[model samples]
Target chain A: MSTAVLAAPFQAVFDANSQEFSLAGVIRPRSVDEIAYSITEFRRAIDEARGVLYINVKRLAQMNNTAFHAFSRVVLDACRTRSDIRFVVVTSSVVGWTERMFHHLGKIEPQITVEVYDSKFYPGQSFVEDTSFIPILRAQTKMTWRHERTILPRHGMRPGIAMADICCGIGDFAVLAQKEFQPARIVALDHSKPSLAYARKVAAEFGVTGIEYTYGDASEMLLEDNQFDFVTCRHSLQVFNQPELLLKELYRIVKPGGRVYITNEKNSHCLGEPRAQSIQWTYNELARLLSHFEMDVELGPKSRRYLADAGFDDILVESFMITNLDGDPQDFADVIAGWEKMFAAMAARHGEAPKFIDRFRQGFRDHIFAALHPKGYAGWPIWAASGRKPL
Target chain B: MNAAQRQPAEAKFEPLLQFEMEMGTFLSDWHHCDQLSNFMARMISHNRTDPVRHSNFFSSALNELLEVSFRGGSPEGRIGCSVFRQGPKERVRLSFPCSPTQRRFFGEAVARTHKGDAYARYLDAISTDLAPSREIVLLDLAINFDAEIRLEEDDPPSISIIVDLPLEGIVS
Candidate 1:
């Protein structure tokens, strides 16, 4: 009866009446002890999830506040009670929380693993993460039915085939592959030993059987020559200094009649002669390299090029905008603020060049974050194109 | 396996021999190891501690880390620690097999003379290299300190004893 002392200010946000909401943003803690306490609360939230919630955190060391400890414990408790609670927490800048979360989840839901993302998109949106990143990225990532709804529309997973994922960062795509079609053999390979080790442990815990998490430079593993079927790469084509070597590696590894899929993010707003030339150097060069792989290449728009370039048949590109601003000036201003800081960061890094900076600013104005708030500019257009490696 | 090649008996580098037997390998390149980080270089040393007849209360606790670092990873990696002493702090190094462990794992350097200077003599004669690995990974033990955990090597084994946390014996 006298539980007012137990009540917290953030507890007000956990309206029992509100069916479900995403905890997509950052909540910094004040102390390390507080960090321990918050983990307990998030556990409660996962246990009692009226619906699935996405936690927006970067790393564990960054999480030191007492309030954050209470918050995390609530979320975790909620995950335990609810069956649909898919703990899709991104672990990059946050290590301690991830460590604790992994320790607990590794013991409990080892079968139902956590999905880790590189967080390449929304690089400068940490402040907005509080109310936005979790939900928007979930809808964007399609934790609910993202794979069945989007990827299924393009590349149909028939059942019983080894799906090779090159540069498998923290096992996101592999988790998706296991959940949906239950691919017979999933060869997930990455260069990072720690990443591979964690992925191996997660895969083992999550009961992702028949999936082998291996360590090697995808383009240069010292294994068999042509040893995979349906090789796939996502959002990592641009990072490699030598895209042609990777493409050649793909050509050599992918079986006859097997397909190769590659995806690279192309910023719609960032373009001009000099800027276009840079994109040409990075993004365009990969496409140019893909053209050399004996298979017929079909380059779809930015969103759909990965599956398409692999020579998948019937390639289609669909563009979706993240525009969901509810007339709240501050909210929209936050989105606008998010964009301003974003462009400022880019401008600072590259310099105040017209085509690169101005064009991107206009795109931000026309379609990326604030102006496209209605569609959630969470994405300008998500590319999806299917190409079949000629059987 | 040759007793003649081991520590305390070998007189030439006898101190260094006694040091190596206790500390395992001398990480000459310990400073370059990736397991630990830069800031830790100033703190924890990997040499042997001084032989001041530590009470059974302390030696019993100090032995846990001795077996783990050496036997936990590989046989070649297995290390047994030699104890040392100062007023509040102690140092122990994991010297290589066949090398004596006069090197300091903790406390201060050994001094050349001790006329009436015990601490200075301890620092000069006992301690080995101070500036080793700069890396300080929480999971690393090649250089950085490890809590002494007494356990049988059984998978996620069970801990039978715990080393005295400096806090317990320090304040009281």
Candidate 2:
């Protein structure tokens, strides 16, 4: 027996014949309190449903920060408790909104499937779709600073200590630091709202407080001078268009004697062969393509130099290697899929000869996977760099 | 001998190692636990004077068991642990508060030990390649509920998992 589920902001109708529950309703909450209340109620209703629950966000309109966080929290909470619920967000041409929602929510629990459709669906109605994205950005959310095994101030999350995490993707480092380091307060700055939202939501999920999520270009971070006791950036250092400027920004914000820590990929040295073997040839070709595309590339060994140029002292750089051979199989698959997605996006922007491109792409993927297999090893070098401002 | 002589000589196990820590719910991430376990294993290997076989064995076992225990409870639940080595035996005691769901999940895992091959395989793996003279390994698990307290109490009942390891290579 199935019963019709009723909740504010959601109306779930159960079909006894098909043994399915469809959730759909207008979710135009007027206030933040309303958003929170409605989301909590929605979760309860969905949880109480007898059959499989399929939520439709297509009818949801007028999404604000309050609404977005509420929606994301409900999905995350559902994922934590049960894996059966399916939440779908439909979009038309502008998929960024839907993508951003899934990007942040999916990071916390990558196992939860979020189905997306491009078709138009009605308000106050529900539908079922089994389609979901590959979740390429899932790995970023799972990144943690605790694994670095480097020497930094692991203590002192007191009320007096201040920390800043520049380009803090989804705020993992900042959150982990705040929880473990006992910092009085921390500011997580990122240019992407979706990433920041996700970070804030995670902070809430972990019950972490005393941290501020700021949305702004990290290179031009508007934090006060000498305002922080610690400043750090992780894998995002390599992605910055102007790393020198970002370093200066890091230097500018740190109080005298405060530390700056960073770890980023050594792109060229990643998964390279010692000789001109077929694997090495594939890596070289990829590098050649990247260079031809005029992408900004950073030298891993020059991290210390960049920090010194930005007016920091006592700089140290150490190399760390990560390989799929020692990692989870699922993560290995994600890495391969991520590479394919990146190449496909690049090809869309920068067209190449179809036949040559397909052959090269296939060869490149095959070589990378073969190297990453358990019998083989594909390792990448990361530079862990740290510096301190003059006292 | 006086009073000491009046009683029979109680068999005492010599202490080889001891460590204790309160791990908060933040360690729900299996990777963090894995890294910590690996680091601890390396530290142990560096400290031990005698040659030891299967150096990473204890760490890997701890990692797997920690994952199992973590999954058995809520992510935000805290765990208090004490690990020690006595004579040729190594023992670990983990205590954590559990919800009803967690309590059931834990009970299921403990019960599955009799019928399933995974738990048996893990026990076998841990027992292989011991130091030299050590004997059998033992696992003791218990879930205790507060009898006198009302259901409204904020503090829930606790579940403890203890594993004892006895292996050969003699020197502590």
Candidate 3:
């Protein structure tokens, strides 16, 4: 929810260039000016965190040392000027050569805070994994951007607690959770063998032993009730056949003071009529489910109202927008148009994804082109909702 | 175990030798820009191992892979690299990347390096021992950097390079 809150003022509300499906939540900004406004709002939000920064160091190789050291000077200045600027080196690597070099490079800039925010791609993935564009447009994504995502990070996560990532695909959240909280125990839950295998390789490579890998249906894991300090459900919740039952399960495992977190497609349409009805139904059931059990829930963008109805007193919502758009939209569109195709191509011997994504390619382009003339493609929805289970 | 002893039996090492895969179109781009000044200040010892993959004169098994990348528009191949006991498990972390290459170079400098257990086999063996716990971070950077290289429908997305520095840096 913090992300939504932090990014809403900064996130582009609509896009004019889109020509694909323009469902409500997927609405696009009619002009670049609208997006520019959102980007400014985002920058202001980022600036709110004293001593925090948003660095654009994509081409590390070509980046000049003068500019490199110049940024370090600002970081150092933040440390010198602000007492809370005690953090240092937000690196993506455990001890990446980049971080190592930064350590030596910034040695001249004393009082500098550095933190490495590396892409902890679950267990077996890399920060620089697949970047082919075709599959990007093929994803069946429906995440939304909400206005109240800033409550938590501003509040900051509860320190010294463990995190449990249910259905931890490729261990992305597991790595992020470890980075965010430095949680003593990061229990990664998943069922697929290959996914589990991939997760295992990642956990090992990044030396994230703090995480314990568990393979199984997360809803059925033999974990203790109220065992987790924080529970996060990423893109996995919407796919559940029984979302309400799972919410109850999530509520049950979170300790009284702990938080239950869920994020979903952030499109505005997801918040609309019948589809919203399904969401409302989930929330309503959560309310009924919790009242019977004497538990309170929080409803962020990801939650159903039933959570608030179920007696969650303090609720929060937010958004996180990473301005990285290098992935292939066609690939993404194909994944959404047809998931099985990518699955088959993944195990293909050669670059055989084209075969599976072939037919959908024209449709994907046609859809985007279609959206552009009409209004724009559907805006992927991403909603985040969280609430505390009262102690 | 010593390098010779650690060597996987032929059956075991066969799979290791045939290991390889390239990502996206980075290889073709990298090949074209191979002479571009190395980015990081440190000298990275990156060597494009033989056959460029499974196809080189080294083996017939690669026959399947060669038909793929050359004919197929995708990046694909199976090349092999390995790890083994170059140091005690504790000290192994530090010596890991270097020791294996040294073990290969130490046995024989050039020409015959890929010959037998002394060189090729040793490289594969070392990769096995270094059960390094890997970590991956999936970043959905909103902009496609490759758009700078290749674009489909429109102009590539431009990354706004904003360098935030307080105005006081100039006055001081």
CA lDDT, every prediction? 0.38, 0.50, 0.35
Query: Would candidate 2 be rated incorrect, acceptable, medium or high by CAPRI criteria?
Result: incorrect
| Most accurate candidate by lDDT | 2
Candidate 3 residues A1-391, lDDT tens each?
Answer: 1122112221122222321111111112222343344345433333454443333221121211222233333444445556643334444331122343355323444544345543432321221133342233213321111222233353225557766777665665566556655776566665443555565676678876656655444444433456677777665555454456566767766777787777664322322121334333333333333333222232225365735654454777655532112244343334333423332243242343554344323333333332233332322335566777778
Q: What lDDT tens digits, residue by residue, belong to model 2 across residues A1-391?
A: 0011111244444444443334333233334465455556666656675435445443232133334445555655666677665544333222223333344344456544455443322210111111122143445334223245333543212335778777666667676666556777677775554666676677778887666676445554434457777787776555544678678878877878888887766565655232225545545555555544443334567788888888888887877665555456456456655665565445544676776567546644664566555566665567778888999
TM-score, predicted candidate 2 vs. hidden true structure: 0.43
> Alpha carbon lDDT of residue A114, candidate 1?
53
DockQ of each: 0.01, 0.02, 0.01
**Number of clashing pairs per prediction, in order:** 129, 9, 130
Model 1 C-alpha RMSD vs. true structure (Å) is 24.7
> RMSD in angstroms, all models?
24.7, 20.8, 26.6
